[model samples]
Target: MSRIVERVRRVRFTWTHLAALVIALLVAAPLYWMAVSSFKGKDEIGANPPTVFADHPTWDNYREAFADNNFGTYLLNSVLVSVIATILVLSLSSFAGYALARLPLRGKAPIMVALLMISLFPTIALAAPLFLLMRDVGWLNSYQGLIIVYTALNVPFAVWILRNFFLGIPKEMEEVAWVDGASPVRTVLTVILPQARPGMFTAAIFTFTACWTEFLIALTLNTADRYRTMPVGLALFGSQFTVPYGTIFAAATVSVLPIALLVLVFRRAVVSGLTAGAVKG
Candidate 1:
C-alpha cells in the first residue's frame, strides 16, 4: 500500500510538471515566432507554409529599418522617455508609498481607493482630454509630455507595490531612526529606502516597460517625426500598399532586447519584491 501511494504521488508530480512546461511553451511561442521571423528573408516570411526557422538568415531587414525607416530615432526616443519616466516614478512613488504605508493621515483609505480607481480607468478614455491638456500647455511633440503622462499612469501601481513592501518591514526601524535624531526625510533616505531596493527595482522595471511600449499616448501627443516611439514607428513600417513582415519582426526583436536583458539581470529582485509584498505585519 505504501509503494502504491508513492507511485501515485510520483505520477501526480509528473503531470503537474508537464502542465507547467506546456504553459511556458504556449507563452513563449509568439516571442519565438517573432524572433525567428526577424531573420527570415522577405519571401520566406510570406510563404503559406510558414518557416519555423530561417533557412538563410539575413541582416537586411535590420539594416534597412534603421537606415531608411528612422527606427533608430524611434528607439532613442523610447529609451530616453522610458528611462526618464521610470526615474520620476521611482522617486515619486517611493515617497508616496512610504507615506501611505507608514503615516497616519486623514482620508487615507479614500485616497487609496481613488488611486486604484484612477488606474483602472481606460487609457482610451483619457486620450482626448490628455491631448487637449498637452496642446494647451504647448507640450505636444515633446519628451516631457510623454514622460509626465507615463509617470502618472504608472505611479499608482508602483505606489501599491512599494507600500506593501514597506508594510512588511519592521515598524521599529523608523522609531530607531527617530531616536538617533534623524529627520523623517533623512531616515527615509538613509535607512529605510536602501532596504526597499527590491521593490524600487520592481517598480522601475514595470514603469519602464509601460513607457517603452505605450502607443496611443505617444501617437496622440508626440506628432513630430523625430519624437516618435518604437510602437508608433513600427506601425509606419508597413505602407498603404506594402506591409514588410520581415522588417517589422526585426524591429520588434530589437525592441524586446532591452526589456529581456533587464528582466534577466534583475529577475531575482523582481521575484523578491513581488513575493515580499504578499505579506504584511
Candidate 2:
C-alpha cells in the first residue's frame, strides 16, 4: 500500500514538472524571440515568417536605436515617473488601508465602497477631464504630472490589496502594542509597517510596472519629445515608409529587462503579498 502511494506521488510530481516546463516555455517564447530578433538585421527579421535563431547577429540595431532616439532621456523619464508614483502609492495606500481595516472611522464602509467604485472607472473616461485639469495646473508634459496621475490611478487598487493584508494581521498584535504605551501612529510605524513589507513590495512592483508601461496617458499628456516615456519614444522606430524591426525589438527587449529583474528579485515578497491575505482569510 505504501509503495503504491509513493508511486502515485512520483507520477503526480512528474506530471506537475512537465506542466510547469510547458507553461514556462509558452511564457518565455515571445521574450526569447524578441531578444533573438533584436540581434538580427532588418533583412533577416523580414525573411518569410521569421526564424527563431539568427544566422548573423549584430549590435548594429542597438547602435541605431541609441543614435536615432534619445533612449537615455526616455529611460530617465520612465524611471522617474515610475519610482515617484510607486513611492506615493505605497505610502498613501498602506496608511489608508490600515486605517480602513483597523480603525473605527465613521462611514468607513461607504468610503471604501467609493474608493472601489473609483477604481472601476475607466481610464479613458477620466482622460478628458484629467487633461483639462492638468492643462489648467500647467502640468502637461511634466514628470510631476505623470507621477501624480499614475499614483492616483494606482492608489485605489493598492489600498484594496493592502487593506486585505492588514485585515489578515491578528488584531491581538496591535492591541499588545497599544497596551505597551505605543500610540496608534507609533504602533503602525514600528509594528504593522514592518509586518506589511510584503504587501508594500507587491504594491510598489505593480504601481511601477503600470506607470512604466503606461503609453496612452503619456502619449496624450506629453506631446514633446523631451518628456516622452519609453513606450511612446520607442514607437518612433517604426515609420510609414520603413519599419526598423530589429531596433524596435532591441529597444523592447531592453525596456522589459529592468521590470523582469525587479520581479525576479522580489518574487518571494510578491508571492507572499498575494497569498498572505487570501490564506489568512
Candidate 3:
C-alpha cells in the first residue's frame, strides 16, 4: 500500500510538471516568434512558410529602427512619463490607502466604493473629454499632460491594493509608534510605510506597466511626432505604402526588455503584495 501510494504521488507530480511546461510554452510562443523575427530580414519575415529561425540573421532592423526616425526621443518620453507617473501614483496612493485603512472618517466606505467604480470606467469613454480638457488648458502635446492623466487613471487601483495591504498590518504596529511619542505623520512616514514596501513596489510596477503601454491616451493627447512614445514610435514604422515587419518586430522586442527586467527584479515583492492583500486582520 505504501509503495503504491508513493508511485501515485510521483505520477501526479510528473503530470503536473508536464502541464505547467505546456502552459509555459504556450505563453512563450508568441514572444519567441517576435524575438526571432526581429533578427530576420524583410524577405524572411514575409516568407510563405514563416521562418522559425532565420537562416541569415541581421541587425538591419535595429539599425533602421533607430537611424531612420526619432526613436531615441520616443524612448526618452516613455521613460520620463512612466517614471514620473509611477512616482505620483505611489505618493498619492500610499497616503490615500493609509487613511482609508487606518482612519475613522465619515463616508469612508462610500468613498472607497466610488474610487473602485471610477477605476472601472472605460478609458475610451474619457478620451474625447480628456482631449478637450487638455486642449483647453494648453496641456496638449506635453509630458505633464500624459503624466497627470496616467497617474489619475492608475491611482484607484493603487489605492485599493495598498489599502488592503495596509489593513493586513497589525494595528498594534502604529500604536507602538504612537507610544514612542511619534506624531501620526511621523509614524506613517517611518513605521507604517516601511513595513508596506512590498505593497508600494507592487503598486509602482502596475502603474508603470500601464503608463508604459498606454497608446490611445498618449496618441490622442500628443499629435506632434517628437512627443510620441515607444508605442507610437513603433506605429510610425509603417506607412500608407509599406509596413516593415522586421523593424516592427525588432522594436517590439526592444520595448519588452525594460518591462521584463522590471518584473523580474520585483517579482518577489509583487507576489508578497498580492498575497498580503488577500488576508484580513
Candidate 4:
C-alpha cells in the first residue's frame, strides 16, 4: 500500500514537471524567435512562414544596431534612469515604510489609506499634469525629470510592500536593542534594515523594471534623440517606409538581457520577499 502511494506521488510530480515545462516553452517561444530572427538575414526573417534557426547567422544586425542608432547612448540613458530611480525609491520607501510600520504617528491609518488609494489611481490620468510640471521646472528632455517621476510613481507601492515586511519583524529584537541604549535610528539601521534586505531587493527590482520599460512618459517628455531611453529609442528604430526587424530584435534582446540577468541573480531575494510577505499576513 505504501509503495503504491509513493508511486502515485512520483507520477503526480512527473506530470507537474511536464506541465511546467510546456508552460515555460509556450512563454519563451516568442522570445526565442526574436533572438533567432536577430541573427537571421532580413530576407530569411521575412521568408515564407519562419525558420527555427538561422541558416546563415550573422552579427551584422547587432553591429548595425549599434552603429546606425545611438544604441550606446540609449542604453546609457536606461541604465542611468533605472539606477537612479531604484536608489531613490529604495531609500525613500524604506524610510517611509519603517515609519508607517514602527512609528505611532497621528492619522497613520488615514495616511496609509490615502497612499493606497492614490496608488490605485491610473498613471495615465496624472501624465498630463506631470508633463506640465516637468515643463515648468525645465526638466523635460532631461534624465533628472524621468528619474524623479519614476521614483515618485514607484514609491507608494514600495512603501506598502516594505511596510508589510517591516511589520512582520519581531518587535522583541528592536526592543532589546533599544533597552541596550541604541537610539531608534541606530536600531533601525543595525537591526531592522539588514533584516528587511529581501523586501528591499524586491522593491528595487520592480522599480527598475518599471522605469526600464516606461514608454509613454519617456516618449512624451524626451523627444530628442539624445535624451531618449531604450524603449523610446526602440520605438523610433523603424520608420513607416522602412523597418529593420533584425536590428529592432537585436536591440530588444540587448535591452531584455540585463533584466533577465538581474532576475537570475536576485531570484532568491525576490522569492524570499514574496514568501515572507505571505507568511507575515
- Tens-place lDDT per residue, model 4, 1-281, is 99999999999999999999999999899889989999999999899977889999999899988898889899999999999999999989988999998898888888789888877878788889998999999999999999999988899988988988999999999999999999988988899999999999888888899899999889888988999999999889978899999999999999999899989999999999878767763
lDDT of 1 by residue, 16-45 (tens): 999999998998999999999989898899
Worst 10 residues of 3 by lDDT: 272-281
Q: Show where candidate 3 strays beyond 4 Å.
A: 1-12
Tens-place lDDT per residue, model 3, 178-201, is 999999889889998899999998
Q: Rate the local accuracy (lDDT) of all candidates.
A: 0.91, 0.89, 0.91, 0.91
Off by over 4 Å in 2: 1-7
- Identify the runs in model 4 with alpha carbons over 4 angstroms from their true place: 1-8
Ranking by TM-score: 1, 3, 4, 2
Question: In model 1, what is the error at residue 253, expressed in angstroms?
Answer: 0.4
As for candidate 2, its clashing pairs are none
Cα RMSD, model 4 = 1.7
Model 1 scores a C-alpha lDDT of 0.91
Clashes found in each candidate (C-alpha, N, C closer than 3 A): 0, 0, 0, 0
Residues 1-281, model 2: lDDT tens digits: 99999999999999999999999999999999999999998789989977879999999888887777677789888998899889899989988999999888999878878988988888887888888999999999888888899999999989988998998888899999989999998988999989999988888898899899988888878989999999999977667888788888889998999999999999999999999756643
After TM-score superposition, what is the CA distance of residue 202 in candidate 3 from its true location, in Å? 1.0
Count clashing pairs, candidate 3. Answer: 0
